[model samples]
Target: MSEEKNESTKDTKNKDKSSDSKKPSRRRSVGIVLLGVLLAAILIPLGVFVVAYATYDVPEPEEVTSKQVSSIYASDAETELARIVPPEGNRRQVELEEVPEHVQNAVLAAEDREFWTNIGFSVTGFGRAVVGQLTGDGSAGGGSTITQQYVKNSLVGDDYSYVRKARELVYSVKMTNEWSKEDILAAYLNTVYLGRNAYGIEAASHAYFDKPVSELTVEEGALLAAIIQLPSQLDPWNDPVGAETRWNYVLDGMVEMGELSAEEREGMVFPETRDPAEYSAYTEATGTNGMIKNNVIAELGEVGITEEDMTTRGLQITTTIDTKTQEATLDSVEAELAGLQEDARAAVVSIEPGTGAVRSYFGGDDATGWDYANAGLQTGSTFKIFGLAAALQQGIPLSAMYDSSPVSLPGDIVVNNWDNSDSGYTTIAEALKRSYNTSFIRLQDDLYNTTQDTADMAHALGVARSLPGVPATLTENGGQPYEGIILGQYQSRAIDMSTALATVANGGVWHETHFVERVETSDGEVLYEHEVGEGERRVSELVAANLLSAMEPIAGYSSSALAEGRTSAAKTGTAQLGDTGQNKDAWMIGATPQLSTAVWVGTADNTSAIFNEWGGNMFGSNAPSAIWKSTLDGALEGQEVLEFDSPGQINFGSAPNQLYYDPVPAYTPPAYTTPAEAEPTEEEASEPEPVEEEPAPAPEVVVPEVPTPDEPEGGGIEIAPGLVIPDFLTG
Candidate 1:
């Protein structure tokens, strides 16, 4: 019995051992696998970091060396037109020793106080900033050191993304190791923008005070340091009020840093800055060409190339400006304005049809001055072309007649023709040749019905500016018939005017205006290439054609017509100077099949009227028109003459005069269209039976939120899809 029990116990123990062996340590195996995975994950990234750090070679601050040397060529790409002058201004490299200790301290206090002691970056400073923010100490600045800024300015010209941040960090650390702290500070001083078109402390000092940096007082140094925060706006010339406030901040920082005594800081005041325009480093580039350089820099920015990259990469920029055209435009402006007032301003801009290439530009004599060519001035009758296009789109025809009497409105305002002449019941073609303002105003009410229709049509046809409000700016998405806009009360630039006319000449296609033709590196690598874009259609081909026809007769009727055999359509405009009955703005907008030009002559202030030596306000057909003809002729001197595409054979008599809530037909049948002297039909010969004329069907009244003297008129309200209130003004 004892032997049997012992054998059973031994059998049970053997069974238990077999069960344990079958499990095969599964949990322990999983633990080992997970541990291996964790180690691999850590080791792989660590290995990558080690290899990348060891292999990474810091690039030289090539842009610093190359930024000053760049060339901008003309459309021919051979003739040098200008150089790359950064919009922030010009740089003059200087050694750190030249910068005063107080200036250095001010910069350190403003940007990075620990610039001398800290590594390339300060993680703890950032941590403290984060903690400080949580504790409501919001004034704590960022953690980027001077070396990191140098990396951003010279090495990594990219976005503030994680990858860019990582590159910046890596480059900063490498820069710290390779370059001394003094060198870093010197690089930052030479590269930093201090406004007034000044790029370095030397340039900035000269720009602000017309003095060298060695003579800068502590207050002046602090002011320069303060300007580094927002060089564009925090300048004495641009934002005097804000500039003083920022100067105070920098001075306080200097006091905190122990660089400035309390008594010294208390006595320091914002220094007076020189006239930015006169002190500009770009003043040497005077006249239209400097603006050309400024524009090219902007164009480069548009193509993802930085100013630093442009110089560092040794890029060659070719602009679309035609040399002959530009020269002729400048000469023409000089000749025509010889007898005019000295303060009179003139601007001319020409564009190629379909391509949107700018051929010639004339802004002002001072390049750093206001860009009159790009500035918005109230357009006059040259704006009528848009009204005509809009009317055509709304089903009005070129042959449609309008009441040419003076127009009266609820605001006691009256739209009158030149000399207030009333050419009653005139044909559209005749009204346009005469530039009858009342006819267009009535067309807005009785024909198109709203200002939005004309404004929309204007926008569609190349008006790059926002209208009363809703019309798409060709520059934006890139509108209407506001009567005021139809008559040229809204503002548009010469470039914008040419763009609209070019759209018409391009069979109603709108191309956004551009400057740069292409960009190439010193090594002949293509950095950027300008390709002609498929344009947005602003108006239908037929509507565009009809609008052209309406303008054709007007140009021929004027003495300011394009050069003979130019075969063009044009409109002249003269804007009234308030209630003075004299003109403030004169504009000539003309377009041929291949080119379009807008020439404007006005006073710089726009308040002073442009009167002729003959003692009258100048008209568009005078100097403005003559300039346009000269510009077009000179621009197309070698080019062959091209005729406009045939106008659409559309004769849809006039606007839908019957389609209104209370319709009073606006179309007047021509007197020549009376019944011919042919034999009458039998039904006509017989006595006609009396028939009742049925009332036309009632059309839906849009009755949009019309502008009164009380409420605001337009802000892009949608009454229905594709239907908006008048974008400019309301009746």
Candidate 2:
């Protein structure tokens, strides 16, 4: 009984101890449960807040979108003017994929190696960065992954505040989740400055090597990649020595990263500058429509492309100029001018037929300070194109007879053929080929009973622009002499002249001259597309064909005596101005199917003496014609043979005013009869008693067998392209 009671007491004591242990354990359990619940409650809300804030689309700060036309490029991409592109302020934006792989690889080696595997931030790197910051030793050296750099750039201001870091971290996490690694890299490429006006890797490549990024060599790639950390400080173009140091550092990094072998690094050579003028002001700014650079510059200024933009902003302007034709035209004009007196200046303008796109232009050396070629001067004889068109428009056949004899007009103004010589009742075809003054005047009278007649004709050909501000007192008769109209008295600029010639070349469509073919905005928006002359037709096809045929003789068959052998059509004009300031304006407008150019040589102080020098005792076909020929001859070099195609068969309805025929004189080289050649009799030697001067009367007006139009028009009246010329032709 005593043992049982002792055991029971022991059991009670044990139960009491167990109960004490149970009470403390239960309290601890309750405390643990409360603490777990509190932890769950705190952590769940914090996680939710973090996620919501991260996913939230916070509006980008204004700095991100802020962009102005910058010196986005360093080299001369477009010669005429500089162009601009967009920027990457916050996050890197999509860049041109023109960057080289080697460059990209070098940048990867230097900036981030585990970039492909990490999210926004590398934990290992971040920890190292923290340790470095705390230790103030820089042993970890910033420890920033490319993503972290991107995130910091995008989400927060560049302030070194902890809040900024926090925001960057959140945004970087969101960005990594939403965007691909390639996308981020591309943005970085475009946004990162490579120094010296080189905002991107591609621009840097061009600035350093004058080549595209895709063509960059390994050394070049390393050099450019080294510039990312401190673009201005390590720009290859701006600071070669410093850039080389950075480049070496990049090479060392590349070596450590196993991207390049030491042998390959040793083989690398820095590229030398090819043309410093690409970044200098020595580039030529020659015009496209016979307008000089000075003129274009002035015009560009008026249109608001400032000098600063042209010199520094790296604008990419694509002009309406066809580089080939432009160079040819310039060369031709220069060649012609080289022969002229040094005191003289010349200009030329050319445009495409259907498109009205300016192909070539020569503004003249006098454009030294400003563009003078675009300035207006008298149309001279080139204006006769309009006159001929007028005559043809009225259904006048090429064979229509016109009295070339001198005619007295309403004001007793007398006009005759160029040399005051009557053409004896000439056919329209003959009159046009010879550029007869009297015949054109007669037609003018028939067309314009009043002053509007000439104006109407001028309007048709776009020459009316020169007739602005002329009052009714200004007789539509052209000038004080009334014969000036027939003699090309009106004035026209190079732009207008090219347009008129294009009217003929395009089968009679007169389109406005356009320099800016297309304008693309900085953000890829096409601000304007120029196609103004697409559907407009200025004249009937028949007239253009007839006119082309008339002009063909000047270039192809009987090409101006000056322009023989070249398949070109041209007209020469020597306008005799009334005063010294109104010098003799010499003009030549010529063209091939591929191109056309108008050349003008004159003194600012216009004088008739120049005309006298150009048109001596002979007809008015000396100086101006020489210039026309010289220019065209050189311009035709290296060009493929192209012949003019007439609109159709040229039709001449009736017989001409007169038929004239004269057998060409037979060629008799000095007769050689050995050493004992017999002398001719006095009667034979007398040259057949010299025919009496009857002033050979005009031949009978009758139609005869005429050659077909297929006889190719130029080369002193085409025989056949391949047919051997007879001794007669040689003579």
Candidate 3:
């Protein structure tokens, strides 16, 4: 029994020892499997990356590499005005040596401060991007080195997919190993789009500063670098404030990177930019329409934009200029100026009331010559409106009486009418309608202790900028006021005159004139939009309505009116070339409720007097009025005919036509006649008179009668001292 027990125990021990030995085999097998899995994890990705790196042939981006053009358009963006590009298609490759060192540093500071030392990619940036792609949070992209940007934009595409992102990473590494840092930078600089329709640093420098890359200042270079992060969004012309803020960030980064000093960053200012229109080879359009470009450039400058930050950003610029209206204006000017002397020049400006948009503009036939539309010319009785407005503001009604006969000034200067005509006494309404020089001169003086009232009124009516030479304390530009301002002796531009008249038509509101309506990027994202706001109210509604009523008959309805339903008011003026007895400048400014148009005719050289086809002096009522009529007739043909907004009837105070002279029967207009038709045809023909003809007669007054109870029931106007009443009316 003892022997059997010993044997059983030994057998159990042997079985246990055998089982322990088999466990080692299982452990070895587990270790082998783990090692194999680790090897696969590392080698599979390595093999896949190698394949992608070798297979990915970095092709230069055809879309960015190709030449593209930016365009300028009329108010309707579809009507392309000009293609904005230099002869070289707005892109010109330049060697890195041509670029200033500071400019290059600025680019580095803006894009990648570690560009010089880093290996073409940011480990953290790439990791974040991958994380964003995997998590679908969209917060991963955008941290790229300069080489990576080039690889993404110029080599691999900027696709949102993970595959593309992976490809970009591989290409960045390959480029760093194969291409020198300088080569990568050159390629990137040559391919990048800076604002203003420019491609490459060379073209960008020229488009922004009108200079070569070599001439770029540190500040300018910094701007170029700053915009690279988001070209269209940070365009200097479209969003100047945003662009400026981003530019400061670039400078700050430069300071942090030791490339620029903190003090230098603080002191740096945004550089002035150039007009992209001037850079376009196609922009040399010498037609009258070309003035639109000039005005657009000027209007943008007024708002602190050097050129195209809000106007052009490799973007579409839609101006306020109406294409059809502009075309019609040119035609009207040419037709009216035809048959006149060779030295004759003409300008026309039309503005939309309440909006301050210049609809039609003609500077002259020559686009590069003197801008007659913008440059000031001697304004004649067209300035009488300002005096009348001034007097009205003083609580003086149009019925106030003034001496219309010749008067002596303090300088012993004798003031006389063109035809040596005298009324003895006439109302302010009659004086303005007839353009009576002596009456306005006295009116200017009687309104204020000083003669500056007329000048102040003129400035208030939106003519100050154009009439800079007129001296008044109201305008910071200093000068003394004379009686000449009341009679339109001071110079004024057609644009300013049009604006003033438009203000009256707009119910006393003064909108600042502007050209660009809006701006948009190539992809149609609106970069800038113009808002027509409630303009500054410079004149009261009563003043504007009364002034319009006084001026109503100056431009007759027969020859010209805004369409048929539109009521119009106008003034005619002619300025003499000293005592030469020839008129040097002639003007006819008119307005409808919706539009105001100013027409001016003068000698091209400004040295000669304007003459008619028959050698007669060209008067404002003839040429300038004809141009005004023709322009309105065509421009307003298909448009809505708006009626004038009446501010009720102007005051008809109890003042006599004359102080001493008895009232005569009113001159009844022919039943079917307008003020223009009431004049004799012989006068309208303008047959040449002798060189000694008295300075052309001022326009006759078309009176508006106001019934009074002071025993003046007879229908009449003011009479001369010895004039006899006609038997037909006085019977």
TM-score of each: 0.56, 0.62, 0.57
What is each predicted model's overall lDDT from 0 to 1? 0.68, 0.53, 0.67
Consecutive 10-residue window with the lowest summed lDDT within model 1 = 708-717
lDDT of 3: 0.67
Tell me each candidate's RMSD, in Å, in order.
20.0, 18.2, 21.1
lDDT of 1 at 439: 79
Clash count list over all predictions:
20, 21, 10
For candidate 3, what is the TM-score? 0.57
Question: What is the per-residue lDDT of model 1 for residues 1-731, given as tens digits with 9 covering 90 to 100?
Answer: 99999999999999999989867787789889999999998898667557766776875543346244357888999877766554444665556778899888888887888888877988876676557656868667565788888778877875857567667777777778877788889889877877666777887888888877888999888889988989988987888999899889888988888888999887766788877666546543657776777677777786799867765554678889989888889988988888788777788988888798888888777656656676656676777777677777777787888987766654344444555467689887778777777777777675444666666666556665342222323221333323466666556667778887998888877776788889987546788888887866666777777778778765666665566577888888776554333567788888998888899998766656786545455777778877888888877887787787777665664333221111111111011111122312222211111211321222222322432111101111112222111112111
For model 1, what is the C-alpha lDDT against the true structure? 0.68
Better of 2 and 3 by TM-score: 2
Superposed by TM-score, candidate 1 places the C-alpha of residue 142 at a distance from the truth, in angstroms, of: 42
Off by over 4 Å in 1: 1-66, 86-284, 447-449, 467-482, 653-731
Q: Which stretches of model 2 miss by more than 4 angstroms?
A: 1-97, 121-171, 236-241, 266-323, 341-344, 354-357, 364-374, 397-439, 448-453, 461-486, 509-537, 555-568, 576-578, 581-584, 592-594, 603-731
Reference-based lDDT, residue 179, model 2: 76
Residue-level lDDT of model 3, residues 1-731, one tens digit each, is 89999999999999999999999999999999999998898899789999988987655432334343445678877876654444434655566788888888889888887887888788777678668767977766656888888877666778767677677778888878777788788778876878666778987887788877998888999999988878878887788898999888888888888878888778888987776566653353556645666566555555454443432235577888788788788888888777787667888989998898888888766544556776656577788788788777766787888998876665334566654568789988887766666777678777654357776666666774322223222222365555556666555678878987998888777877777788666445775678899877776777788888887866762244455756788987776554445566778899987679999887765545677555666567777887898888777887777767664544543222111111221111011111121221322211111222222323442222532111100011101121111100110
**Residues 250-296, model 2: lDDT tens digits:** 88778787878888888777756444446521223323322333333
Q: Estimate the lDDT of model 2.
A: 0.53
